[model samples]
Target: MDIIPQIRAAMHTLLSTTTEAIAAAQQYVKRPDRAKFTPSTLVQTLVYGWLAQPTATVEQLAQMACRIGVDVSPQAIDQRFTLATADLLRQLVLASIQPVIAANPVALPILQRFASVRVHDSTSIGLPDALTSTWRGCGNATTGGGSTLKCGVQLDVLTGTITALVPTITGWN
Candidate 1:
């Protein structure tokens, strides 16, 4: 099946909703004066690229930015994945859900069995010693020098969308 149209439709829906969220949150005020990439542009470009190619790399993201007239380097694009960016993305994700659900209500009999279907999972990753101060990883029993980053995600099964992403340097909750 051709996926281009589906991707385009999804992108349009997400971008419009994210644009509205960015405006309401006044997210651009946090950026520096000479910032070339607005929060809306960055979110749109990253989401579109990921939707088009799930395994897309930073180089590919940079190319996508270029196509959208951003002209940013791969390093810059990678660096943009900071905590603030993650928070912005999370806000946009939450903001998009209401609109999507309102526009396309789920009426499948199988899905209607539950009030809400949420899937939760968590993972832990080892991090460099330097990030211990910033990220505050759990103390290692063997190698106390290293740190661990734990991330948890909650997805809405009916909508096939991520409802929450919780990142912590501490142990999983």
Candidate 2:
């Protein structure tokens, strides 16, 4: 079956999320020097353009904007997303889109009605390089190296979606 609809839906979702991120980020006025661009629209355009075809580029994004009559330049797009922190936007991409694109395991409807509850626990991703820092290091394990705290996240499993997730970050090494 064609996956165009699914991809289109995902693109819309990404656009909406990116828009919301910009709106939220705009409220934080703690920084005065931050240059302003249409954060929401720019991000939405980027994600939409990225999803629209097999080959998407910054130039293509600008073209898409032109097609939609948004009047954006390639440099403007870069300045909006790259020069700006847009940390909130990036965080949402990592936290939402990445996970959605990954293993979005959900409980079967038939299984959902069962009394049995699903459970998920902590998971870790170790870097190949040793983590040697001033504040943190590998734990006192002889094999793994110095006593750097283990890293990972604690996530809960649910029938329809992730109920909760707590990031497990090791302190500075």
Candidate 3:
């Protein structure tokens, strides 16, 4: 099966076609009503930028945005690292992977001994000080105050399914 076309079509639908869906997914109370940084543009910039360079800087991401037809400064990109943007990105990720389903099953005596094999992992992401109100972090003399978001996930390997995507926990303070 040629999956290249399928990948292209999926990307097109996610990044450019479904305008209303993107807007609805990114809805936040304080989100400014402006065209400068649409949800799709932000999603494209981060997704492709990180894929191109895993450890990309804000300037690099801004350049990626430019390549995708949006002109903005690195500071503008930096300012976009907010709670709302995080939520939007999370929602997009869930939406993107929700359709995936493993077709073939692996044959293994040890694996078949159990009903399902589950894996769990968690990580914490530091955020700007402005987000302290939403995601409080450890306070120290050097940084005064900060914020972070703790994300955790659980996947069942037997059927290739994600059982949990918990992002409610805040930083350990």
Instruction: Give the best candidate by lDDT.
Output: 3
lDDT of 2 by residue, 1-173 (tens): 65678777766765666556555655623343653334445665765687796467678989877765578678866655532345545455455544344334556786666654456566444433434443253444432543233323333333334544544434443
lDDT of each structure? 0.70, 0.53, 0.72
Report how far off residue 147 is in candidate 1 (Å).
12
Cα displacement (Å) at residue 95, model 2:
7.4
| Clash counts for the predictions, in order | 0, 13, 0
Q: Which 10-residue window in model 1 sums to the lowest lDDT?
A: 97-106
Per-model TM-score versus the true fold: 0.53, 0.45, 0.61
**Per-residue alpha-carbon lDDT of model 3 for 44-83, expressed as tens digits?**
8998999999989999999999999999999999998876
**Model 1 misplaced stretches (Cα beyond 4 Å):** 1-13, 23-29, 102-173
Whole-model lDDT, candidate 1?
Answer: 0.70
> For residues 10-104, could you state the per-residue lDDT of candidate 1 as single tens digits?
65867766565664575543655777777767886798789889879999998888888889998988888776776677667656554343223
lDDT of 3: 0.72
